[model samples]
Target: MTTDEDELYDADEDPYALALRSGRGPVYLRLVDGRRIRMPVHRWHEQPTVADKTVLERCIGPVLDVGCGPGRMCRALLSRGVFALGVDIAPRAVALTTAQGGLALRRSVFDRLPAERGWKTVLLIDGNIGIGGDPQGLLRRCGGLIAPTGCLVVEVELHDVEERYNARFENLQGQSGPFFPWARLGRRALNSIAADLALSVTDQWSSGDRCFATLAHQGSSFDCPDAGRR
Candidate 1:
């Protein structure tokens, strides 16, 4: 079983090692577009408006940031009048979030989720498309963890699977530097994942040269959040 993620290139570092060592990671402003650059780790906690407004308007109920990092998005949401929570496999990340006056948990999405169905809106942004190996599996797992009316917002690189990661991919990516054969999960892939998870995307947009997708479980027919219902 894939318990912890590490870089095959480093051979002695966790996948998050680069993130922790450099104290920085990329934040894709949009769900697609695919380009991400390593930025200051503080930026992850700053809560930029680029990705925050999109989530604030569409997400319903408490929000969960899967891989919440230093609570950047979480902090942004709180400032926008939305209650947010965070989950990350990196202990340092969890600690950073809590230090920022946010509710965060130190756990992997593979272990156990803190909330039940329709309980909270979960954010799979910031390269969350690669959360659990396969995007489909990741979304499916999210489906089970989401509440009946919960939402799952995702972000992916909007590029070819191979070219994006610049990888040949024998088994899986994760064996090197800033590049890996991570599937971009563009529009087509996003739609398929949403369908597989019994979800329907309600809104999408781009910011800071990034693209994003907002998905939700709305019974059978897809619909937006309403004042009466939510």
Candidate 2:
């Protein structure tokens, strides 16, 4: 008889989880319109890239990496002697992170997390700003996760597009997982949402095909060693 843990593992046999365990993927996010957006799984499994460095440089110590997939960012930060913690809803993700010597927790951004409002840098990289398909709600939650002088670093779409819909994880072979709520926000859309949350966009820049923005509380200030060097 299969145990409940065995059943749980069996039920997680989706493309995303498989890719994480194997460290490879041609995984795609199948949108409701039938359009597929390719997910950069290989990059997530590898060491930090030049583009990733751009994000890493802006981060202050005691960082929180929301949706940290394979834990590359967390690992990188720890190697740099920066205290970082990665959180994800996937067990495999947290396992891989700790296995690689990075601190991680299997938890959702909306769930109760440690160090509430005390993290110096909160990251929503790899399109995680779209976590719940409710960008405004997500941003509000992130605002509460950072210190008053801390900042939130987010990666936005390269193009000008804002959308919310259900999406599935699909492999190249056409196998797919259950549909879940997802969203996409360009820089402009992110800025608008940040404004409503009383968060100010402190910086914005592009590295290769990815675009990023930094948001902070209206009157608070924090030290980013690489600020303005981009």
Candidate 3:
């Protein structure tokens, strides 16, 4: 079977990696229908924003940041005296994180992660819920990675929509990378998936134009009582 990790091997020549190194974008996620979603590589490389702080404040110690592209969140957490580890399939991303004094590993979330089921919090920000084009499968894997008392902090679409598609990275200079499976889940879709996985949506909130949710094992309180509170 071709695992999710197998699909995400980073190449030195990938346009996304190049963009990360340059700290500039015009990088985009091009869908099969030729529609493009502009990726915020610049924002990712910059300091965490107000919306990002909302997510950051909810994170407890020993946080696992999935698809932690450039590691701004992890770095911010470290500054806050929180233990955070970033995991990414992209080598450049990991290197940047480490360079910024944040600890990171270049590995897929689907792979054998350290301290499985023991993380205090797991993050799926920057539209990473779309990884593998399989939200249910991804969440199921995250479920196993999180401790019983830990919660998943996810950023969902601002509107109600659910989609799965093949996508590739494209740069403004007309360069394109290989296609990969991806998915998008709105709040309702995420709630449905959590219910099916025996998880519950304990909280949902919005920051600016962004939306977020907290999911935990059924009937369990989060490790941090004030998580997601303003």
Candidate 4:
């Protein structure tokens, strides 16, 4: 019943603290400085900002931040009084997340995820669908992370662009960067993935052309007038 993610996030030690000690938190790293690479040194959250006020206001109990590089999202979850834990594949990112007072662990999603069955939310923003370049798998993993009434919140843009290998995207700093191997899922993609995991889209919102959707294990509550729809 327990997974490797459970062991990696044990409460005793801060898994990502060592990375900060080495000071590589500023940007992604390149072992060879080119094509086929190891993995991205995910950008740590720089400043504190509420990306989603309504859903954040509703986060509960323990939270799991998947692909938690340097723990920015995990730290944000904690700010709401949720016992937050950050899970990542990079030792460096693991360090950063813990340095920020979060329970961080260096582990891949392919391994077990932190086992908090009743967690209120599992955050997958920042093109998290790119994990292994499979959106269905990502949502399937998130489904196991949510409590019965809990939600999985994700962000996407209304626009579409060339889908390529090791895709590039602008960071919070507005600097062009490699967000690699991402699968751009639009509204239709979102609905399909949700159903694949047997989850229902409950609420949605949009700003400008960007959109956010909240999926719950409960049936679709896409009744909100402001909820983004096709």
Q: Judging by TM-score, tell me the better candidate of 3 and 4.
A: 3
Q: TM-score per candidate, in order?
A: 0.71, 0.92, 0.91, 0.66
The CA-based lDDT of model 3 is what? 0.87
How many backbone overlaps does candidate 2 show? 0
Model 2 CA deviation exceeding 4 Å by range: 1-10, 13-24, 227-230
Whose TM-score is higher: candidate 1's or candidate 3's? 3
lDDT scores in order: 0.62, 0.86, 0.87, 0.58
Model 2, span 27-60: residue lDDT tens: 8889989998888888888899999999999999
| Candidate 1 Cα outliers beyond 4 Å, as residue runs | 1-13, 21-42, 160-182, 218-230
lDDT (Cα, tens digit) per residue for candidate 1, span 1-230? 43223321243433453454322234221112444444344556455665556556666557778888878777776877888888887676776677778778988777877665654677887666765456777787787777665667777555534222432211113333333334447766787768776688776667665667768775734343533344
Determine which window of 10 residues in candidate 3 has minimal summed lDDT: 3-12
Candidate 4 TM-score versus the reference: 0.66
What candidate 4 gets wrong by more than 4 Å, as runs, is 1-43, 50-55, 160-181, 208-210, 218-230
Model 2, position 173, has a per-residue lDDT of: 65
**Residue 127 alpha-carbon offset, candidate 2, angstroms:** 1.0
115: Cα error in model 3, Å:
0.4
